[model samples]
Target chain A: MSRSALGLAGSLGTTLQRELQLAFSSPGRIVNPLMFFVIAVSMFPLGGRMSAEVLGTIAAGVIWVTALLAVMLSMESLFRSDFDDGSLEQLLLSPQPLYFHLQVKVLAHWLVTGLPLVVISPLLGLLLHLPEAGYGPLMLGLLLGTPALSMIAAIGTALTVGLARSGLLLAVLVLPLSIPVLVFGAGLVDTALNGLPLTGVVAVLAALLVLAGTLAPLAIGAALRISVH
Target chain B: MLTVANLGCERDERVLFDHLSFSVANGMLLQIQGANGSGKTTLLRILAGLNSDYTGEVLWRGQNCRQTRQEYQQALFYLGHAPAINRTLTPLQNLRWFCGLQGFSDDAAIHAALQQLGLAGYADIPCHQMSAGQQRRVSLARLSLSAAPLWIMDEPFTALDKQGVAELEARVDAHVTSGGAVILTTHHALQTRHLLTVVNLDALRTESA
Candidate 1:
């Protein structure tokens, strides 16, 4: 409707485009987490050589846990490069509120890092010998849950962005908060395996996504400001 | 029309500067001078709203900068110590995003700004391939591309050679003569059309004591 409003929307897209550019330019940035998710989950199956029954039950836990870690591994770079290169300061000085820009940033991250994890997840499930009934819930759950994981990792990354050697701090901050996503996501497959109704689990995962989408940005915006300061 | 009133700041239990007060208006150039650790960068960051640990207030058109952040930021441009260029990104891409944050960016303006900073024909190359000074120019390209009235720069001439220095000095001069204001910290002696307003942080410290 107005010039500033147009620019506000324009900046968000521009931020997304820039983030995608950064992520794609270094293909390893996107690929590493995917590899980690695959390799680490693969370890679960080979290490124990368990029977199908046992593997099927624990598959969701292993997959959800690995996916959560994959997002965190990819998430640290969300703001670290910007902070190191001083673009974080520029971001802080922008006239538009940081909330929307942060949403766009995490969205780009999800597109690059989270989407790939979702796509190859069934392959990982197959490797783990997941039950046929559980496959649908597993994919559906990750598709819904990983966005919330990405946002949580974004907050953790922003909180420790100012410090060097922040990996442990990132885990300490993110893993605890991620318990809800892990619980609900893994439970979806478990519930489906038992031939339970999917509506309640679906609603909870959707609510977590919505809740994270709205609330995480506020913390992310503040964390970025303090980090830059 | 920016003003600072009785500004004071401390870091690590040491008073870097106290009771510091100055104002920069249209068509004026203010240079902040001090020895190492005198807080020139911190002062600039405070004015730019990057640091909030300071005492006193910064006003943009007589309104508290904190309360009027959006309007104040829209009217201000700041270049700090780091070049702010992503090594993996090309100059064109970097400037596009930088100007986009301020809600204005176009290829024509970005190219012209790069050329102004002696970066002609170098826009497409990734910044990591460029030399340090060239990278700095990529960051400095924001000077011409922005319409904000007040610019606060810290050590903008850090890696520049003679020509780069002269080019930046001329750019700063043109900005001030055209009714824009600039506050900068640099070792390079600047010869501009307007008289320079210099603030020495060491002097402020002594007066406070």
Candidate 2:
């Protein structure tokens, strides 16, 4: 009873650890998105009427679309389980800043869901007959960009977590916001394929990351407060 | 001190309750009484500052609860119908995370509280393995570990056994006597040494609606 509360670092570590533990226990969460990304990406190579060069041209668009869809599909679980289990209510009432909790949840999410996609994307890029120059940009772009997806999707998930059927509603709410990410994300690889310097593409994706990194937590926090009430 | 003046809340275009007012100080146990679909949970949610769509203001130490939210929330604990423990987590992990958010990281206290709740052996196992009442116990263990002075609980007694019910009543009595205020909604008749102040939501429904 005499024990005092912790500082920011202490609680953040606890929350982050808890989030990771939850992710680990639910292997389906990690495996499902990855499987979806791989399956969806693998299908494009089998479609008829495309030469290797033609497939190579659309590789950036195809990979980016699948990655975006995987992240978006996985986004529903970000807050959905917490909301259903009532842990979200306790989370909202916690004395700690909601912003910190949002950061930890989204960070854990990106690590488990988004990070795997980024890691395996190079292989998927290869399968699609990506131009040799596009490989490096594909991985780098996803590394910077998927966090933005996770963050933005976290906002949409927070907004709709209260609903019983959040299926298409979540996608509709998140896709419009995610277009810029898809455009710049695919653009990075496309520019590299065209033998252009990736300076602008990388810079834009990084800026988006920073913007989503700082601003996402606030929006998600407010949305969580609204949904719970 | 906590105060509510002219409080009114409506849900689904139906008036839940109106003109409700009350106050609580240290060492008070207030029970909210109402039948099904009554505003008992809504009232607790408003008092806990979870629901904001209401007519009146909730005051904490003479300031608006929303205005002084940080300080007010710092002193409050809320347990709703959901056990709130993630199914994938063990009792210890769940308590560690929950108490961690309240700014407390005392692992020993969490352990002792779990043991007191008859969960010492069950602490490390995933909560999905536990029965319904035991899962509820994992959440109730917070009542013993909480340092917050104000507690708002909705249907806290729903899934408890006889012993669990008795133990929770004792815990509430101890908390109230030790200068913490508890507001809860329950159909179970409580047996406690402290005087219970009942807020009947059904009667208010008639008076207002």
Candidate 3:
């Protein structure tokens, strides 16, 4: 690898490793979001009948909403620990591009918080009596969509990171931005259930992911600088 | 070289300091002294290019620091009031990650710096298991590991034992002797015999008031 590539690889590898270590070392941090997703989704079924028709009617919407909340629940943590402990200061001082590092952080957060949801969606889909055909759309949609959710949530996380308690404020700031993701994610299953072509919905989501992957990091980087200052 | 001219800052509609100006060149140690709430930390933050809400020019090598941010940051090392230590990670892991964030990773050098900071046997132990001073030492280990020409430290002596304080002072002194520059804030008196310059923000505060 070239010098710049080596540097990028080294920094990216270490940061991802650090994020994973930090998340896993505290089992609560890793478990809380997953549990929140499971519990939140499970509550929906208990609130109503066990009929496949009723469960399937709500599963797409319920799972998407719960997944959104799960990501938001873990969102405050994206920058909170660093901001509180002064590592954020060091991050701002780093010679490497803040945009790149911030992107790495968003990716790490999705891995620990959003990836599990994607992996377990089929099980939840089954629990919710979702149509077998809907399972593919649900999993693929989340796989493409959650990263965007994470990136958008990161903007709010960075904006409010300096505040002592910003969880609610972060949700308020981010939820509006998350509407597009939620619409398309749930719409994926909805389209499949309707026997319509799902490409248009997935295409939009992929575009969103790409757009978020390219742009959100810059906003997140700028927002973190403002908050820290 | 770092230079500030006619700087002014206000917080929550209260003037923290105004018309403050100072400069630090290679081989110099400029200690910023001030009472509580006197803006020593804020001043250092401005100089380090972390805080830009102030009014004035912070010039690096005769150019605006903002325009030359990448180069400026490349040559700068800042230690904030907090040690930036993560409780879950060992000192060695923290240092390695910190260096990696700066775009390099050297395990041997990280170990050596930890050893130099009197943390040889404590390298692999998680920071939560260590005393506050030892945690502070882990942050201080970055001092020996960094080759940045400009060091901006805020209250670096906090939680240090007498020997740790002495050792850090010696490190700062050696840094200046080696043609690096340092801007630091400390309530504790710095005993460095290097080319020391003092910028007391308290006097600036009172003068502006």
Candidate 4:
């Protein structure tokens, strides 16, 4: 590879490391989201959900909503720290393409927060009394769907970084955007629960990932440009 | 050589400056003096290719800066009013990250630069734990590591003490002595006895008005 290619790779790697370090540094940040996930799943059992049938019927929605909320909870830290401490200005002034940097940031976010949600979905599914056959589809759907959440959440993170109460504002901005991922993800689990072929739902989840991968960076870059002004 | 011709900058309908023309050749230091809120920082941003809302032509080596932004940026190092250091990472980490972005992979040079900035002991310490002056020094350390020919700094001495100010002045002198060009905005009267040109933005604005 040429020198520029090496530099770009290094930039991405360093950014990924920094993001992971920030996410896991204080237990407060990571633990809160994990607790939120557990509590959300537990709610299914509390609301007359002790029966396996009752819990299994609502398992997919519970898991999807919990994963979505976990991602949303962690998304605010994406650009807030950089913006607050003036590192965002340096990023904007860098000689490399800012869009490339933004992409690296989004990827890092998925690796740190979204990847964990995928890894832990099985445990949450168990709590909700998910059927054995639904496990694979749930994890698969989450693996494909969570990155879409990250990409969509980045747009909201960039837009609300300049606002005073950006946390609540971010949820308001991103929840509407995350509906497609929720639909496909939950649809896959629902299909599996009913003994129906999940090929269609899985395909839609993949399509959503591709669509978000293509368009989310442009939206994020535009939002950063507006907010930095 | 760098030249700005017919530069006009505005923010949200308020005209900061208009029809400003300036030129600096090799081995020259241009000090832009202006009062608070006089658009000095805005002018520097326009020069550094970060702000595009302005109307004018900034020519570098006879090439239009706006059209050849990457090429121009490759030759320019801009330090804004805010010290752009990541507080979570150690100074060494921040430097390594920045060097990586600039396509530099030499850690020895980065270490040498940190030492030169009197930050050798604190290189591995996160910037958030350092004092303001020390954090500012980390930003100045880039001046030693970068090979860019043009330096644009906004209030580089704002957080520095007397000793730090002198240290920064020495760095600026050394840079100018090596045939590099510098454009800086400052409230302090720089005591450099080199070939320096002072552009009073307040006077220029009054004349233009």
Identify the leading candidate in terms of lDDT: 1
Estimate the TM-score of every prediction: 0.97, 0.97, 0.97, 0.92
Candidate structures ordered by DockQ, highest first: 2, 3, 1, 4
- After superposing candidate 2 on the true structure, give the runs of residues whose Cα lies further than 4 Å from its correct spot: A1-4
* Residue B50, model 3: Cα distance from true site in angstroms: 1.5
Q: Tens digits of per-residue lDDT for model 2 on B1-209? A: 89989899989999888888999999999999999988888888899888898998899999999998889888998999898989889999999998788887887888899899898889899999999999999999998877799989888887899999999999989889989999998888889999999989898887765
Q: Ranking by TM-score, best first? A: 2, 1, 3, 4
lDDT of 3 by residue, B15-109 (tens): 88898888889999998888888888898899988899999899999999999999999899999998999988888879878888778777878
Clashing residue pairs in candidate 3 are none
Q: What is the iRMS for every candidate structure?
A: 3.8, 1.6, 3.7, 3.9
lDDT of 2 at B129: 95
Query: How does each model score on lDDT?
Result: 0.90, 0.89, 0.89, 0.83
Report per-candidate DockQ.
Answer: 0.55, 0.73, 0.57, 0.44
lDDT of 4 by residue, A34-143 (tens): 67887877776887726788788789888998899888888887888777776787777677777777888888778767887888889988887898989999999999
> For model 2 chain A, where is the 10-residue window of minimal lDDT?
A1-10
Q: After superposition, how far is residue A219 of candidate 4 from its true place, in Å?
A: 2.6
Error of 1 at A222 (Å): 0.8
Model 4 interface CAPRI class:
acceptable
Clashes of each: 0, 2, 0, 0
Worst 10 residues of 1 chain A by lDDT: A1-10
